[model samples]
Target: MNAETASPILAPPLITFDRVSRHFGGAQGVTALDDVSLSIRRGEMVAIVGASGSGKSTLMNILGCLDRPSGGRLLIDGQDVSALDTDALAALRNRRFGFVFQRYNLLHGLSAAENVEMPAIYAGRPAEERRRAAHRLLGRLGLQDRAGHRPSELSGGQQQRVSIARALVNDADIILADEPTGALDEAAGAEVLALLDALHAEGRTIIIVTHDPTVAAHAGRRIRIRDGRVVADEGDDRRGSPATAEAAPCRPGRSGPVRLLGDVASAGRMAFRSLAINPLRTLLTLLGVVIGVASVIAMLAIGDGGREATLRRIAEMGTNLITVRAGAPGIRSLADLTSLTIGDIEALSEIRGLAAISPERNLRTTLRVGNRDYTTMAQGVWPDLLVARSRQLAAGSFFTRDDIRSYAAVMVLGQSVADILFPGQDPIGRQVLAGRVPFEVIGVLAPRGVSGGGTDQDDVVLIPLSSGFMRLLGRSHVSSVTLKVADAGDMERVADEIDRILFDRHHIRNYQIRSSTAAQIIMSDSQRSFALLLGAVAAISLVVGGIGVMNIMLVGVTERTREIGIRMATGARRRDVLIQFNVEAIAVCGLGGVIGVGLGLGSAVWLRRLGFDVLITPMPAVMAFSCAFLTGLVFGWLPARKAAGMDPVRALAAG
Candidate 1:
């Protein structure tokens, strides 16, 4: 190859069109650009003059990468536009095309400087660099003083100038101005035209789309477009095939981690500013998420608390223990006593693996202490119960073996019974009459408030077995036999043995013998399933909240359709728009999550104060917050995609 041929000193044309066509509908639809072939060399100042319905605007849309050609391929600096995805196309526009429009298209929430820094933001420029570039460009454009002012605060001419500064922020290679001075007065319009002339003189490719002859005169070359066709051209029409042309080396836009962070920051700021536009609506939307998350956490907390309490109760009753009732549940009165007798209990106590037995019988009668008459429940139990049931003595010693054998009329009052019978005095030696039978109070059991089964644990009296059966109740058979087995693993075997011994002795089919451990397992499993069901119901709120977010975002996309188009025309990638909307949704959900966690915890505390069990673990809150964030992402995607897929020409016209 010749040295000159391989030198790579000469560059391809900056922009090209190969018989490009842009049509709106099917065969009978409007043809915006019909078989338009064009190419502009680097630094050329070309004017595309056309009437309102002409194809100049359509050509501009294609050149800016805001719209695609229907019939032919477009090439930028020898790179086929069709080969790049939506995001890559946006990156190219951000780096190469600077746009100035008649409507200005300045973001209302951003200051002049910030609006000028937008393309740089997409270009992965840091905050400091974007600010520095914006200031420098504003100074050059004679709008330095207006840099901090928003578009609404600036005059029409000032807004137009700020937009020009924005177009130049990334040092874009091509400046596409669509009636740049159409909205300005004669003096202001002349100033903008002169600015364009200066930029053209500095070797920046300038393309101005306009119908006015006065504006067209400022360009070095004029191309007239009529009926979606280029009727005339005054500049180079040379075109190169994109497939064969040497491709220009372009930087992969913002690919590094640092650049990714910068883009995230930009999206965050934009989303936040957009939220500020409708504060009440944002708050309402956030409220939905907060309530949903709080409900989930709170419901789980309550369910877990109840389950834990029940488990503790079951655990308190020794797992190695077994309970045998005379008859099935609901066997209440002594008159309804079953075939169970003291002889049957004595036989069961001899079974292998049997550790100890406590035959309990109860009597309910009006007992008199001093001049006060009160009704109390009395249980006939032995001293062995103190260790077997984990009971503690508050005062005095329990009855010995002699008390049961002699049928002594002595009793030990529960804490609740003592409080009612003795009041502020000691009950260790007090005599209380039970159903006209006098009984001596020997000791007081310490308070055991309430059991897991909702039974009042502190409201009974314990006396000797002989006293309750012979003296108090005057019954022959015992109430129930509770046995403690030697090995926890043998509890099941011992329960079956008791059932077999009782069935043979009583010659009755009605009886029940159960292991507390089995009951614990059944209770735990049932409670767990219930908690899960409750959580699932609460989770429905999260779904509803996510739907609300999607609805709001969809409305936002509709309301800001024009703004999205403006950004697209100014070199924003489709991903940039998508990220911006997603950022907004996530921000809402994240903030709501924080608030919801606090609310859930506070609610738990309040419920506990009201005597309800509430277990507040970090897992539920974390899971709820995570779900809320994911909800935003899932729901926000549709609106973001819709915004990204919009047609720039149609959007701008709607605005």
Candidate 2:
């Protein structure tokens, strides 16, 4: 039996459309396909010919399952195609049909072989098998030498051939070619048509849509569609019928190679490659996110550290310790003899829940030890003052209770004051003169670095309170009262007790009693406020970074318009286009986020080295990363939607 005689009898129609029509727009409607009905059989070569606006491309879309008929029964391989939803249509297209567009829709960053593997990738083929199949298809298409070349590096003809190879990679039953030779020269066009013919001979169904009569002449049957209707259906004598061609040496079915965990790995690899291709833009877009993350982390770390240090210092002072300083009475000085007396401290000490109370007075005077004389602030208090203030003695011993009772001239010098007065000599047991009175130095205080308020507590002198009040100042007044309570939880009650005691003893009313816990709380609240302020400033940068991402993604959509059009024309669903572009944007922003995190941590380390007490703990790092990724998603969504919703025909025309 000759190849030309047996085609129609052996071939089974794979596609059938019964009175299908598609319309666009709302209210004022435009009909894209009007009552179109057609049938395409397996193992047959058919062409659809029409001028622009004749609905040939629309019919091709319906045939490829890219778009559905508005009001008709469409069937593919005896299955009701029009009844399937969008996702089902996409799955059917992936499993049963392949598409080849005039403008090759290869990813710009990928090599030719990678582009050919895309359909199989969408079909969820394993990596190794997909790669092997892609290589085979490329080799078969006479593009083995150009397999590693990017789309930009290939000629228009070569790109089209790669697209053809991709269409066949899935081994789909139907191949829909929409002006497959439109972008090629005569020589390349003839070569592509020959490839299609060879595939048709292998018992594969092929449909070509074109306006060129010469292109349609190669098919065994040609269907002329005009105004959304089939104007002519004619069988050509030049090309033999499909049935006899199917009996000839058929090409062996190619099975894709199986790979373990292929989908995630392949998508990640593609994402990485795409990012590597545009380094500068990715870096700039991530700058804001990085700055925001780093700033928030650093600020919080510093604030927390400072708060912890302050609280530790306060705890060391004594868990339930409280201080009462005599403020100026209207216009009177704190040192005025008419204000506080020793009776006030004795009264406060006798209150319930009170542990101890010490009266204190401060004097600004010059200290002289041997030949060295320096000016320093002196705090006058009893022997119990050291215990309430949590002072640590570095050398010698603190003043005894006997010294306070006998009014002995004794003093404790802070580290800095000791260094200044004694120089290289030991200050313990040495006599130091404060203004006119002389006192024996009993101890040298330990070094306590800078406090939260930047005050150097190691630059003062301590003396017996009675000696400072009676002998030096020649008065019985006290500057402040220090008290320790039995329980921290009873701080408010104890404070009230002390206030009542002082008010009763001095015959005064409306006096305030402050606790150390309140001070600590105030300090912490202030620090938290500062941290929030810093975070707000940093958030502005993140917003700017998000804007940068949105702008770049919009630009990317514009730049890849033709690529998007080609993908859509090749049976990619609207959601698929949306996801692909969104993934690309996410990939770019994610790369930026990774780089920013590294930089932020590095900056924290650098600041710590500069003595700024910075800590980039795990929580802050995690928060930073989360912020970066979220920014990408929030900013990249609109542009991705724009790219996905673009009209394929108009997008292709844009180029």
Candidate 1, run of 10 with poorest lDDT? 237-246
Candidate 2 residue-wise lDDT, 105-175, digit = tens: 67788899988877666666666788999899999888899999999999988998898888887777678
- In terms of lDDT, the poorest run of 10 residues in model 2 is 244-253
Q: Write down the lDDT of every candidate, Cα atoms only.
A: 0.81, 0.75
Give the Cα-based TM-score of candidate 2 against the true structure.
Answer: 0.87
Among all candidates shown, the one with the greatest lDDT? 1
lDDT of 1 by residue, 1-655 (tens): 1212332333357788989998988899999999988777666678999999898998998888877888898988777895677777777778788899999998898999999988878777678877998999999988888899999999888999998998888887688999998999999999999998888656577899999899998876789999999999874422222222332233344567887677778898888888898998898888878988988998899889989987776655655678777775566535347567778878987899766677788777788877898887888876667755767889987888799889999988889888987889988877888888898888888787788668878898888888777877676677677888879888777878888888888677466676777777888999898889879987998889888988988998999998898787766777778888888889888888889888878888898888887898999999999999998889889998999888777777666
| Residue 197 lDDT (model 2) | 82
